[model samples]
Structures are given as structure tokens and as C-alpha cells.
Target: MAVLRTLLGQALRTTRLSQERTLREVSSAARVSLGYLSEVERGQKEASSELLASICRALGVRLSDVLRDVSETLSVIEPEPAPVLVPVAVPAMAGPGTTAAELRSVRRPVRDVVAAA
Candidate 1:
């Protein structure tokens, strides 16, 4: 997975370009330091939730929308994890027979057979 820095940087760059907003304008609107916002936009630093919220507001987008866009982008780039494996044990039982030897048979897998009286 791409680090949050890279992720946010990509998001910031894309958002800024799409909205035709400069980094300086966005930083002021988001009430963050210009240098800090620049680092975030370059993915050099991780932005806090508050900072992200402010940026989202500046971009005129909701946090959920930003996350959804990120999710879709990540799905396109990331490989799926392997499926989990689980083990199941089947039951074992003695075989049926008329004679003592058959009755005393060791435990074995059940077999489908017709019973006789």
C-alpha cells in the first residue's frame, strides 16, 4: 500500500488541479501553514484529520467524497490479498457388520451402504 503521505499528496495535487486552486489559496482557506500544506501536497508529511477536513472544505468536497475517490483509485492500483484458509474435520466411526470381527472394526470413514435386517 502507498504510504499516507503519497496518498494524500496524490489527492491534493489532483484536487488542486481539478479545482484550479493554487496551493497558497488552499492553505489559507484550510487555515494551515503554507509550508505544511505544501509538504502535504507533495506527500512529504502526513496530514492530520483536522488538516484533511480543512483541506476538504477548501476543495468544496466532503471527507467521504475524498475517501471514496481514494478508495476507487487504490482499488485500481492495489492487488487483492490472498483468501483465508480454514480446516474442517470430518467424523469417523466403526463399520457395521453381523459378526464380532465386523462389530469390532476400527474407526474409519463412514461409507454409504444399504442396511439389512
Candidate 2:
């Protein structure tokens, strides 16, 4: 599964790298611990909304802009697919007649999961 934290981290790291800034500098500006910031950049930890906002401000970037970039990145990484849900009817009793052909597979787009949230 594609993780939102991972994408968010990538966006933050990309912006930081593009600006040629070091973790210590940005962490200091954001008033966040250097170790914690490193963890956030590595996607090992999820930053709270307030922390994210502070990080964005430190990077001189808007939170909305970072979100937009993350959304675009996720879209590219997970292309939309046609909706599909197939159900297979099974007998109540187990028998040798059961076969792989009797099974059905269901597939749905990732957007569905996001929309449900």
C-alpha cells in the first residue's frame, strides 16, 4: 500500500534538498528536534498538523503547496483503475467439485479507499 506519511516525507525532503538546506538548519528554524525532523524526513514518523505547518514555514513553502505536491505524487504513483467487484457463489458443503474457477476476484481503485475516509 502507498503510505501518505512516506509521500509527505518525500515532499518535504525534496523541497529541503532543492533549497540546499541542511536538516539542522531547517529543524532549528522550525523549532523541532533535529532527531525528530530526521525521523519525519525518513518517513519513520508522522508529523502532526502543527508540526507540518511549522516545517513548511521553515522551508518558506506553504502547507497547501506541499499537500498539492503530495497529492500529485500519489496520483502518479497509483494510477486510477476502473471499478471492479466480482462475487463468487459457493456451496454450503465442501466437496471435490470446488475448484479455482469457482472463485472470483475483486479489485477497486485506491481512490475509493480515500473517498470513504
Residue pairs whose backbone atoms clash in candidate 2: none
lDDT by residue (tens digit), candidate 2, 9-112 = 98999999999999999999999999999999889999999999999999999999999999988988896676655343345553677665544322344566
TM-score of 1: 0.67
Instruction: Give the best candidate by lDDT.
Output: 2
Error of 1 at 93 (Å): 9.2
CA deviation > 4 Å runs, candidate 1: 86-117
- What lDDT is reached at residue 16 by model 1? 85
Please state every model's RMSD to the true fold in angstroms: 11.0, 6.4
In candidate 2, which residue ranges exceed 4 Å CA deviation?
79-117
- Alpha carbon RMSD to native, model 2: 6.4
- Give one clash count per candidate, in the order shown: 0, 0
